[model samples]
Target: MNKRLVWPLWNLALAIGLGAFGAHALAGVLDEYGLGVYETARNYHMWMGLAWLILAVAG
Candidate 1:
């Protein structure tokens, strides 16, 4: 509930939401290669969000 955590938490939530959107809404829209790229970026985003969360908590 700390204000410092808000941005990191929001980033995490947005990453999750975007992942879900790509999986479902864009399933048929993107081809295999495009989907793979999207997944990779999403994974990175998720990881970065986690890192941010950790930094916010530790700092």
Candidate 2:
């Protein structure tokens, strides 16, 4: 595997980990408003992570 490809994969891995953390570890700890904010941010971060992976592979 090319070294350049590692970064995007790492980014994707991080997103997945964070997503799980937000969904599980923080699920009940935060209030509704806080949870909403976390989800919104996580959603965008996940999307960007996906995009990074796609571009890394295709570019």
Candidate 3:
């Protein structure tokens, strides 16, 4: 695969890992309100990162 593909794949993977960590670890460590914020931020970040990944792959 191209380097572009590899980089985006790596980024996508990192986003997934971070999102999972936030959900699994932060949710319990933080209070409900804080957890909600963390989840929203991480979820958006992951989704935007995925969009970038798709753009990288397509363009």
Q: Quantify all predictions' global Cα lDDT against the true fold.
A: 0.97, 0.85, 0.79
User: In candidate 1, what are the lDDT values of residues 1-59, reduced to their tens digit?
Assistant: 89989999999999999999999999999999999999999999999999999999999
Off by over 4 Å in 2: none
The full ranking of all candidates by lDDT, starting with the best, is 1, 2, 3
- Steric clashes per prediction: 0, 0, 0
Candidate 3 lDDT, 1-59, residue by residue in tens: 77767766777688788878887878768898987887787678778778877888789
Give the higher-lDDT candidate: 2 or 3.
Answer: 2
The order of the candidates by TM-score, greatest first, is 1, 2, 3
Which residue ranges in model 3 land beyond 4 Å of their true spot? Answer: none
Per residue, candidate 2 scores C-alpha lDDT tens digits across 1-59 of: 97767887888788889889989999889999999998898888888878887888788
True lDDT of residue 6, candidate 3: 76
Model 3 clash pairs are: none
